[model samples]
Target: MSAPLLIFADTILTGFDPDGTPILLEQAALLIRDGRIADAGTADTMRRRHPEVEAMGGRGKAVIPGLINAHHHVGVTPFQMGAQDHPLELWFAERLRMRDVPPDLDTLYSAFEMVASGVTTVQHLHSRAPGDVTAVLDRANRIIGAYDRLGMRVSYSFAMRDQNRVLYDDDQVFLELLPAAMRPVAARYLAGFGLSLDEQAQVFYELRNQHSGKERIAIQIAPANLHWLSNAGLEMAARLHDATGAPMHMHLLETPYQREYAARRGQGSAVEQIQRFGLLGPDLTIGHGVWLSRDDLALCKENGVCICHNCSSNLRLKSGTADLNAFLATGLPIALGIDEAGINDDRDMLQEMRMALTLHRPSGHHSPAPTAAQVLQMATRHGAATTPFRERIGGLAKGQAADLVVLDWDRVTYPWQDSRNGFADVLVRRAKAEAVAQVMVAGRTVYADGTFVNVDRKAELDRLKKWQSRPRTALDEEMAELADAAIDVVHDYYKNWR
Candidate 1:
C-alpha cells in the first residue's frame, strides 16, 4: 500500500542500470516495494516525497551489488579441504575420494561459507559421485531452499556424464593389453571413472523433472569431461535446455593434458566437439577454458556462450591462470568464480579478485593494473549473469532488487577521506569480510553489523566440524602419499601421448 524507504550516503555502486550504463550514484536514495527497487535518486528528493518511510542512515558506507559466485562444487568432500597441488586428473581423483564422505549437513555448511563471504548467489555443479541420486537431489533442494529463504539466488547443476559406470567390461581385456603389474591400478582407475549412457541420461532427466523451474530452482548441465560423455548425453542436454530453459555450465579444456589426449585419440578438442554436438548456444557456459584458442573465444562470442573464469581454483590446481585480457578483449560475456567453498584457501570475492588480478602478470609489457572496480563488477554483475538472476539482483538501480552489501569504510577501506580518491579502489583491494557492515537480500537485512539474521553461523560451522568425516584414508594425506603414486599413474595414463 506504501513505498518502502531506503537511503544511503556519500556513494552507491549502482551495479547496473535501465539506461545500459551502470554508474556510481552519490548520496542516492532508493524506494523499495514488494522486494524490488521502485525508484532511486538523491536522498533529499525521495525522502521528501515518501514522508512516512523508515530511514537507514548510510553513515558513509558504500553500497554495491551483492557478490555472485559463478562456479562451485559446494558440497566439496571434507578431505578436499587441502587439495593436492596437482593437475586435472589427480584433482578429479581427489574430488572422487572427497565424494566418498556422506553428504548431509556438511554439504550445506559449504554453501553457508559462500554466503557469509558476501557471495549472495552461487552456481554449483552438484557432485555426481556414486551416491543415492534421489537423496543427493533431496539434500541439494534443501540446501538451495535455505538460500531462497535467506534471499540469495542459487543455480544448481547436476554433474551428468555417461562414464559414471566403469567404462570397461572385463579385466581380461586390460590384462591382455597392459603389463600384469599395472592391471590392478588400471582396473581401479577405470572403475572409478563411472555412469553408463543410459543410466547417466536417466539420472539427468530425473533431476530435470525434479528441480528445474520449481520454486526458483533451475537445472544446469555439467558434462563431466570429454572422455566419458557420449553423443546421446549431449543431445539430452540440448533437449533439457529447451524443456527447462536453464543454462548449461559445462567444463571445457580445464587442462592441456585433456586436450592432448583428445587429439591423440582423434576425439578432437573438447570445445570443437561440443560445438559439433549442437550444444553451444546462449545458455551454454564453459568453465576453465584455459586452453581456448582465438578461434574458441571467437566461437564463444559468436554463439553468445559465456565463460566462468575460476581464477583462484585454476591457480591452486596449477591449471594456469585464466587468460583474463584475452577473454575481456574478445568482448564476450565473462563471469568470476572462487570455484570452491574455501577456494584458494579463502572465502571472499575480495581475495579471489586480488588473485585473479596479479597471477597473470603480462610479459614485456606493463601498465596500470586491472581496477578493483572492474574486478568487483565481474564478481557481481558478470557473475550474476551466470544465471537468469542477472536481471534481478546484479545491479543497484531503480526497479532492481534492493539486495546489496554495505561496506564499513572506516575500518577496511581505510582513510576514506574524499570521494575524489575513488573510494571504490580502496574497497576493491583492502576491505576485509568483517568490514561488511550490512548485507541485504531482496530488501531484507539478512546479515547486518557483523551478524547473520537468517542462519546461525556458529551452529552451521559446528555442524561442519562435527560431520564425523569417514575414516582414515583422507585425500589430503593419501592423494600423493608416495611420490611414486603420482608418477606411476601419470606414466600409465600419459605414456602413450609421449
Candidate 2:
C-alpha cells in the first residue's frame, strides 16, 4: 500500500452538495488513501491530522474535481477530415468519406487532447467501425485498453444506429436518384458497418462482463441518434438498458431537420417516441437537445433524463443553440459535452465550460441563467451522473475517487486581481488548458509538468501522423467521390419531404 497523499490547494470546488449547491472551500487540503479521498478539510487541519503524509501543491494552486465530458467520439474531427460545417444531416454523409485509422491510434489521439485539457472522465460514444463481430469487439477492446493505459475514467458505448445511414429517410429512393456510375459506390457507402443489433448487444454484455470490474472503465449502450436508428434499434437499446441496468447515451433533436423528421413521422416529438419505447429514465442521457421544445424539456426533467449540452458542437454543426435558460428553469439535470467538436477544434473542457456559460445568456431577465459555479458542476458532478461512474468519481469527498486537476493560480490569474473575486468565476473566465499544472486520477498523478506519466504522447502522435501520411487506396478515393455525388440527393430528399 502507498502512503496517503495530502493535496493542498489555494481553493477547492467540491462539485456540488446533494441539494445541488456548490461546495467551495478556501485553502483546502484533501487526503488520498488507497485511491480514494479519505478526508477533505482546511490545509492546516488536514496537515495537523496527517503529519507524515506526502504533500502536493502549495500556495499558488487551486484544485477542482476533474471535468467530465458527457459526449465524445474517438479521433474523428469531422471538419479536420473534410466533413466541413454542414448541418448534422448533410454532415453525416460527408463523414462517410473520412479515412479510417487504427482504433488505438484514434483513441489515443483524442484522449491526449482531452487529458491535456483537464478532463479525467469521458463518455466515449464509440463510432461505427468496419468489421465482423470478432473484429468489432477487438476494436472496442483496443479503444478501452488505450483509455485504461492512459489513466482516464471512461464510459465506453458502442454506438448503435441501424438505419438512415445516408439520408433522413429510406435511402432507396436517394440511391435511385444517384447517377448510374455512382450507384454501386453509393450502395457500398450506404451499406452500414459493424455487427447487427443483437450481436452488438451481445458484445456489449460481453464487454461489460469482462471490464466492469476495472476501476477506470465502464460500458454502456449508445443509440447513435434518433434519425439514424430504426424503431427496432431503439427497442433493442431500451431492452439492453432494462436487462443490464446500463446507462444510455443518445443524440436527441440536434437539428431543425431532425425536428421535421419527427413531425413528419407523426411522432409529435423525438422525446415522445423515446418515451413511447420505455427508454426515458435517469439512466438515459440525451445529447445535443438543441431543438427540444419547452414540453420536451419538461418531459426530460420529469423522467429524470439528463441532457448533455454540447454547446460548441451545436454551433459548429449549424445546429441552433439549446434554450439553456429554460432547461435551468425546468430544473433539468444538465451536463457538458464537447462532442469532439469544440469551438477551437480541440477537446478543451475549460473552453467548453466558458462557452456554455456565455452562449445561453440571451434568455433575458425572466429566465435564470447559469452561473459559473453551476456550469462547473455541470462539467463535473452532473456529467459524472450521465456515465456509469456516477457517485464514485465526480467530487472530492470521503470515499470518492481522487480524480482532480490542479491549476497554477499564477498562470491563470497572472494579473493578480483582488482575492475577493469568486474563484469559480475567475476560473471559468480565465482558465485554459495551459494553466493545468497537474492532473490526477485515482490518487495517482497521470499528468504533471506538461507530460503524460503512463504514455509517450509525442511518440504516439508521431506514429499516428506517419500512419495518416500513407497513400490512400482506390476504394477510399471512390468513396470520397461518392459522398460528394450523394450530397445533393440527400439535400433534396429533405427538401422534397412533404
Candidate 3:
C-alpha cells in the first residue's frame, strides 16, 4: 500500500448536483489513503488537517473522476488491419481479413491510448476468436493480465455467440450461398471456432473464478448481439448473470438491419426477446442502441437497463444515430464508448465525449441538446453503473476509490477569456489527451507527464511493428481471399430486408 497523499487542484469537479448541474469547487483537495479517498474539502482546510501527507497537483490543475469506456472490442482497429468501413452487417465480413495480433500486445496497445486520454477504467468486451475452450481461456488470461500489468481497471467479458458467425443467418445456410469451391474452405475456417454453448459457459466460469477477488479486474457476461446469439444462447447468458451476480453487456439493435432481423426472427423486438429470457434489468447494458424504438426505450427504462452510446462507431459504420435526446428525456442511464475506434482511430474519451455532446442537437431552435454536465456524467458516473466497479470508482468522494485525472488547466484554457461558463462545460469542450497531465487508478499514478509509469510505450509499439512486419502464411492468404469473396455475398444477403 502507498502512503497517504493529497491531490490539490485549482479546480475540482466532483460530480453532478441534484438538479443535473455540475458540482465544482475552487482550490480544493482530495486526501487519499490505502487506495481510497479519505477526505475532500477546500485546499486550506485539507492542508491544515493533513499537514503531514505528501502532496501533488498544487496549482494550474483541474481534477475530475477518471473517465470510463463502457464498450470496446480490440486495440488495433479493423481499418488498421486493411478493412474499410461499411454497414455493420458488411463490416463483419471485412473483419475477416484483419490480421491477428496476440491478446497481450493488443490489450496493452489500447491501454496505452486509453490511459493517456484520462480513461482509467474500460469494459473490455472480448470478441470471439477462432479457438476452442482451452485456447479461449489462454487469450482471456493474457488480456486480463495485460490490464493488470498496466494498472488499469477492467471489466472483462468474453462475448458469447452460438450462431451467425459470418452473417445474419444460419451458418450452413449462409455457406451454401458461397461458390461451390469456396464453401468447403470457408466451412473449414469457420469450424475452428466450434465451441458449443456449454463450452462457452465453461470458459466464462473458468475466467470468473480465475480472476476473482482482484482489485483492478472484474469478470462479467457479454451476449454478443441480437443476431449472433440463438435463443438458447440468450438464456444461457441470463443464467450466467443470475448465478454469479455479474453484470451483462450485450449489443442489441445497433442498425436497421439488426432491427429487421429481430422482427423477421418471429421473436418480437430484440428488447422484448431479451426480456422474455429475464435478461432485461439493471444488471444489463445495451451497446450501440442506435435503432431502439419508442417501446424499446420504454422497456429499457422500465427495467433499469443502461445504454452505451458509441458515437464514432455508429457514424463510421453507417449505423444511424441513436436518439440521444429521447434517451435523455426518458431518463435512462447513458454511458459512452469508443467501440472499435474513435473518429480518429484511437481511444480518446475526451474526443468521444465531444462527439456525444454535439451529435444530438436537432434543427429546432428550442430543441434540447445535452448539457456538458450530462455528457460528463455519462462518461464517469453513469459509465460506472455499467461495470462491476459501479459506485466504487466513478466520483471522488470520501470513500470512493481514488480513480481520477489531473488536467493541466493552462492547456485546457489556453488564451481563453470566459469564466461564466461552468467548469464542466469549458473542460469538456476544450480538453484533449494532450491536456491530461496525470492519471491515477486506485490512488497510484499510472500515467504522468505524457509517460507511462509501468510500461515502456515506445518499446511495446516497436514490438508490435516487428510482429506486423512478419510475412503472411498460406492460411492468412487464404483467409484474405475468403474475406474478399464473402463481402459481396454478405452485402447481397441484407439487400432484401424490408
Best by lDDT: 3
Model 2 residue runs over 4 Å out of place are 18-20, 192-194, 363-367
- lDDT tens digits by residue: candidate 1, 273-320: 888877788778888888888878888888888788888777767777
What is the clash tally of candidate 3? 0
RMSD of 3: 0.9
Query: What TM-score goes with each of the models?
Result: 0.85, 0.97, 0.99
Error of 2 at 29 (Å): 1.0
Q: Output the worst ten-in-a-row residue range by lDDT, candidate 1.
A: 163-172
Worst 10 residues of 2 by lDDT: 186-195
Task: Encode model 3's per-residue lDDT on 1-498: one tens digit a residue.
Answer: 999999999998887776777777799999999999999999999999999999989798999999999998899888988899988888888888887898888989988999999999999999866788989999889998999898999999999999999888899977998878779879997898889989999999999889888889999999999789988999899889889999999999999988998998976898998899999999999999999999999999899999999999999999999999888887877999999999999999999999999998888989889998899999999999999999997898789999999999988999883989878888879999999999999999999999999999999899998998899988788888888889988978878885
lDDT of 1 at 234: 76
Q: After superposition, how far is residue 213 of candidate 1 from its true place, in Å?
A: 5.8
lDDT of 2: 0.86
In candidate 3, the residue pairs with backbone N, CA or C atoms under 3 Å apart (3 or more residues apart, or in different chains) clash, namely none
- Model 2 agreement with the true structure over 4-72: per-residue lDDT tens digits: 899998888877776666787799899999989999899999999999999989899999898899999
Judged by whole-model lDDT over C-alpha atoms, candidate 1 comes out at 0.66
In angstroms, how far off is 104's CA in candidate 1?
4.8
